[model samples]
Target: MTPTRRGPKKIDYVGAQSDGTKLAADLPAAVQVPDDAVAWTAVLGESTVRNLHSPDWKTREHALQAVMRSLGNARWNAERSPEDVWNTVTQLLDKALKDKVAPLYYASLELLSTLVATYSPNLPYGVLTQGLEPLMPTLLHRVGNNNARIQETSIQALLTLANQPALGLAFLAPHALSAIPKKSQSGAAAAIQMSGRLELITCMLNVQVQQQMGFGTAGRTPAAAAAAGKGGDALMAEDVVRFTRPALDMPDDKVRTAAVRLVAEVYRTRKAAGQPFEVEKMVGAGLKPALMQRLA
Candidate 1:
């Protein structure tokens, strides 16, 4: 027994071949975006865009909604052409806007937001400007929808649109002066509460990043620095007065928490910069106490 010692066999993972031939470990996957029309046609047909718009078959409507929801994951690979993908998405969005079914419409908006997140910024602005703008009022109405999920999805769509500065300003400019009066419905309140928190946090971080980078300085090498400064200034000036103040006083704890965090971040940034910590001036009107409590 002492004389018998068997050593472990060394397995070469890299060198191991499936057959007699050498394996190409780094080879790309075989399935790719086809240049031909067949693949896209199949995707279009399978997406049930037409069926979702049909007035008949309630079950088809539901099924189409689910398919639209899942469409976000279908094009994960970079094989599809941007034009083809955008066309398909725009078609789906068009049908969704026309559909009387609320679920289908919500799913479509969710897919649109996913497209914004996943795709390059070079996507046709016409789609957003022409197609989406007309739908904004309807979408805003849906933000107070009875269904919590629908309302949330609508908020997400708005936030996604807001990522594009031109689109954001266009959409907001009209409504910025108008009051975003609280909805009578509880579901709408819940949705606004959730979405407002997310928007506030994003805005705060954006301003902080701009401030850290010294955005407006002439010595900055990147042209984007000056643009960032201008953008940050605009966001703080507009949002602090409009969105942030309202959010700070929201009835929901989550909304208040996010508003507080934003106020605290702004206060800290200004303090560090030797700028006046004018909490009252920043928050405006009635939110000083809540903002102060959060900062403390």
Candidate 2:
């Protein structure tokens, strides 16, 4: 008699019910699609939105992929009211960003990066701030994600958002400052998060300085661009004085180094812009002491 055959043991994955549900094929890469060919409505229909909330990971994953691929399509400009569409999709994105599955989480972040890169310039100020500002904390915290690639991707997303003219350095400064702790903690993980936040603040300031100096103004009229740059410069100067002093006292070497680099960059940017930065007056007595302590 043949030996009794054993069936494979059954194992259940939590939250992955209907895992075999068939979904539409993945959309083509965004670059493959002709610029003027597709509209936002066709790409993000009712079915795709429904799939994003599906219990099956693959369905949600595919839905996000479709949105990301079709995000750059040409018809966003023709929509009657983009605020309505932005609000709908951003709410979906908030949920998707918290997805437990790795692929889905990364896909959500990638979509966010694309969303900011593509729409920041075109969306109305109220709409852009309302839609994207709330996501800043999530992106900042994700910098400490265990996956290295995810960390890098999150930083790239933040940088992309920062570089946009619609949202200036001031918008991200509050989130970055709030993410770092007031009191230093005694763990490696805390240090890493602190370092990431500090580095992010530095990058944001660098982007702002570039903007204020007329480096990346592609579409705005010269007068409008100069006005926007001045607003950003004033806000950024305040933030530098607010945070750099405490950042220098952080326990991590990397965090301290980032703080020092941020200060140096501020001086360099102010000099290049032909703006006088009276460091003693702007940063006050506190920062000088902190810098002196760090040097010692």
Best by TM-score: 2
Tens digits of lDDT, candidate 1, 1-296:
57986532211111111210111222223222223323445555543533433334354346445554554565443556656666666645553544444544655576677665555254544554544554555555555454566656666676566545334432433432234444432554554534544453454345345635754222122322232333433344335445556666667776677766666766666676687766666666565564566655
- Residue range 167-236, candidate 2, lDDT tens digits: 6554555566663543324567666666666666676676666666678742233333343344334235
Instruction: Write down the TM-score of every candidate.
Output: 0.48, 0.69
lDDT of each: 0.49, 0.61
Model 1 lDDT on a 0 to 1 scale:
0.49
> RMSD of each candidate?
16.9, 9.2
TM-score of 2: 0.69
Model 1 scores worst on lDDT over the 10 consecutive residues at 12-21
Give the clashing residue pairs of candidate 2, or none.
none
In angstroms, give how far residue 154 of model 1 lies from its true place: 4.6
The most accurate candidate by lDDT is 2
